[model samples]
Target chain A: MTGSPVPPELYAEVLHFYARQMQALDGGDFESYAATFTADGTFKHSPKLPAAQTRQGITEALHEFHKKFDGDPVQRRHYFNHVVLEQQEDGSLSSTAYALVLTTRPGGRPDVGPSCVVNDVIVRDRGALRLKSRAVDHDQEFAAVAV
Target chain B: MTGSPVPPELYAEVLHFYARQMQALDGGDFESYAATFTADGTFKHSPKLPAAQTRQGITEALHEFHKKFDGDPVQRRHYFNHVVLEQQEDGSLSSTAYALVLTTRPGGRPDVGPSCVVNDVIVRDRGALRLKSRAVDHDQEFAAVAV
Candidate 1:
């Protein structure tokens, strides 16, 4: 409504998707977070990391990763800022943003981690944008806080 | 160009700026990266971090951080994806993108940190959309790798 001529509904749905992703991460609901993507969704961290080595066979991988975080912490925060969204030639959308993850371990300064940039390729699924692939670039490092 | 109705020149400039930023970082040219901002430019990690944290007086801080990498044996790669940019009401631009940071230390396996979503507010300065404030949100951890 304020910038480009993207359909109001499209923009709203995208924003909603982002909000839901953040909420799921903060709530420690990895199931929901993992569901935000399509079955063949790729989550590449780097070309060197084996966790997300390729664009194929990631649905099961996400499930496994979520299981790792299931019982690690009761509370976690996923913060996103400086988000930019672009519509591609095929009507699909792509976006990037900065993320900061914070964790709380009972009492003490929340563990603060690095600041990274996120790159995502999304598609329209059931009238909403579902991430097809997500890549994160950590640009800043902190003292490795717990959260 | 293919997505939004942004003027071609403005769009090209923005793209160029990002490419330059990435090149500077990869080449370990922190001074050039820092010069991309104005005297009052802001570099923020998250909502909870310090505001603007102006770089004008952070020379020592910048040097200390840059010293960690000797630029060899550490292969740092950053991927920018799904970029969406909008021309704002104030003639500035608002953008969001997903970022992925991958790092490989000397004789170590590559580590893929968390994903980040970047929200950038920029203004055209001297025919370029220089970054004004970059507020990063960590989808996992903060500054996991040097971008």
Candidate 2:
């Protein structure tokens, strides 16, 4: 809310973008999920995890990930909340939000995998908003290791 | 996005209002949390749960609810996302968002209690946004249950 007044449409657009990306991923439509990012976009769950270095990389990774749930009735959903957007001089946007990974299975209780923070660099490609990069850091990762 | 372009500011305001309310509740500032609702506000987690019929009622309920967490290292975080804002004819805003209740304990894995949908009726009170009503529907509760 500080600095010059920002157009309200930008806020809604930012949220709508996430709605599109997450739903596509949860629905197992990796192609639509990958469409939310630029060709050379990058995504990493954490510094300790392998990252997808491009749109195709993520799509392929998602396909592999989808295989893990085979024969089991399970669902994973990513929810982003408390988003804060900052405009960059490079005509990109820095979007920071709290993310929760939720898993649901038939007859079993839903589970929260982790509470994490997600940082995304969003850019306009062909007049559509797309992510340039995304990174996640989980709360448990902050705990000390016994090693 | 339909029925004549509404000011984008309204969209941002709706999201921000949720941000404030959720943080206040999670931070255990019941007074600040209660202030988010109107004097005649109503809140119910679900149709089967008890309802708070007024701001005063919710504040008292929160105080009683806080006692249940006594002596345990636990944290509850409410996350709201995938929000859609609609302008109503009565000058109020109808805000619908997904709600996730996440619980974390020291040295224990964080768990997701439920994936829920929250519908809030937000109205302006002395130029400030306030919730007139809030109702939640959880995914699990929708499943078939035997008597």
Candidate 3:
């Protein structure tokens, strides 16, 4: 068998990070979600909107963006697949994924939204993987991630 | 650092299997979806329902299942995460995942449905990985995977 270029532990760590981080976002624990990013991390949703440049900014932006959902009150979820990871010479990782957004009201049907792709710069922060940058590019307009 | 018990390539192959297989299911390609299973594969969705006993049966069941969606005509998606894989001594894989089913209509809101867990026995068939058995257990009643 050919040797794997990347370490298996790295894959485990990254997947673990996603499992916890996305749960925080979907579960409305914005603080815990934002904490997965580096202190100076940036989250850029689109070219039109300014990037959330810090952890505090990310939390605040989530709080504001969620205001609209309060009226409709459906649970929002993010599912990512086809995660391709490449390691930089400097030891950081560049990860890309196809992302899907799903929402549902209590006792209602689920609707899967527009297709999107996310590219991220992940780095080791105090021995754990943290996002240094996250750029979400939507193929079309979806109310959930509209910025 | 300790060595990884699981090979990195194993993780890669299992993920690749999921990526292609789920796309086939959500994309309305029942033949392609069923082809991923072993010829004698069994799919048991619940204790109440009899398992789809073979690949042909799996395809037929999918055709019948999608009839319900024809009137609604929304995309049905399966998203899986938190994958845990264990390898048997005989080189087969026992994989488990937390799954989410999403649905959406044309120009409509997306809904995320009930939580489910899927356990599968994956084995090599003609040098390619194929599902030997898939057992999906739902946490609650969800119309999408009612069978």
Provide interface RMSD per model, one decimal: 12.0, 6.1, 7.9
Model 3: clashing residue pairs? Answer: A103-B111, A103-B112, A110-B111, A111-B103, A111-B110, A111-B111, A112-B103
Tens digits of per-residue lDDT for model 2, A28-107: 78887788888899988676979897878998877786677777656666888778988888888898998878777655
The DockQ of each candidate is: 0.02, 0.17, 0.10
Clashes of 3: 7
The parts of candidate 3 lying over 4 Å away from their true place are A1-79, A83-97, A101-147, B1-4, B141-147
Q: Which TM-score values does chain B get in all models? A: 0.75, 0.88, 0.89
In order, the Cα lDDT scores of the candidates are 0.61, 0.77, 0.77
Q: Least accurate stretch of 10 residues (summed lDDT) in model 3 chain B?
A: B103-112
- How many steric overlaps does candidate 1 have? 58
In terms of docking quality, how is candidate 2 classified?
Answer: incorrect
* Local distance difference test, candidate 2: 0.77
Model 3 agreement with the true structure over A1-147: per-residue lDDT tens digits: 112245556766777788888989999999998999999999886756899989999999889888988778888888777565677998889877667877889899866666566789999999888999999965444322321
Residue A9 of model 2 has an lDDT of: 81
RMSD of 2: 6.5
Candidate 3, residues B1-147: lDDT per residue as tens digits?
255366776776677577667766766787887888888999886756788978789988888877886556566567788778887898888999988886656556557676789999999887777999999988785546666
Maximum-TM-score candidate: 2
lDDT of 1 by residue, B1-147 (tens): 113445545554565687788677656676776667655677764556674445553334456655776555676665554455777889878877655566788789866534556688888678655777776666544322211
Give TM-scores for every candidate, taking all chains together and pairing residue i with residue i. 0.46, 0.60, 0.56
